[model samples]
Target: MSKKKSFPLRLDPELYEILQKWAADDFRSVNSHIEFLLREAAKKAGRLKKSQE
Candidate 1:
């Protein structure tokens, strides 16, 4: 596995709670869900290359 970058992220309490529930529904941690969402969005926007995806 490649080394993943780590950074601090801040979100509003309401947003965080929503993400927590969504993550649980998908059987994923909140962090992983966020990454998944971002990756899919990048792909849809043509911002992510095939290899990257």
Candidate 2:
């Protein structure tokens, strides 16, 4: 496994609540769900290399 970077992020309360529910529905933590969404987006946009996937 790779060492993960840590940083603080700010989100609107309403958005956070929505993400919280979505995360629960997916059986994931909010943090991991966000990362999964971003990774999928990057892959779709061809911004991520194959190795990165």
lDDT of 1: 0.97
Query: Candidate 2 residues 1-53, lDDT tens each?
Result: 99999999999999999999999999999999999999999999999999999
Give the poorly placed runs of model 2, Cα more than 4 Å off.
Answer: none
TM-score versus the correct structure, for each prediction: 0.96, 0.96
Cα lDDT tens digits for candidate 1, 1-53: 88999999999999999999999999999999999999999999999988897
How much is the lDDT of residue 23 in candidate 1?
A: 99
lDDT of each: 0.97, 0.98
Which portions of model 1 show Cα errors greater than 4 Å?
A: none
The alpha-carbon deviation from the true structure for residue 17 of candidate 2, after best TM-score superposition, in angstroms, is 0.5
lDDT of 1 at 12: 100
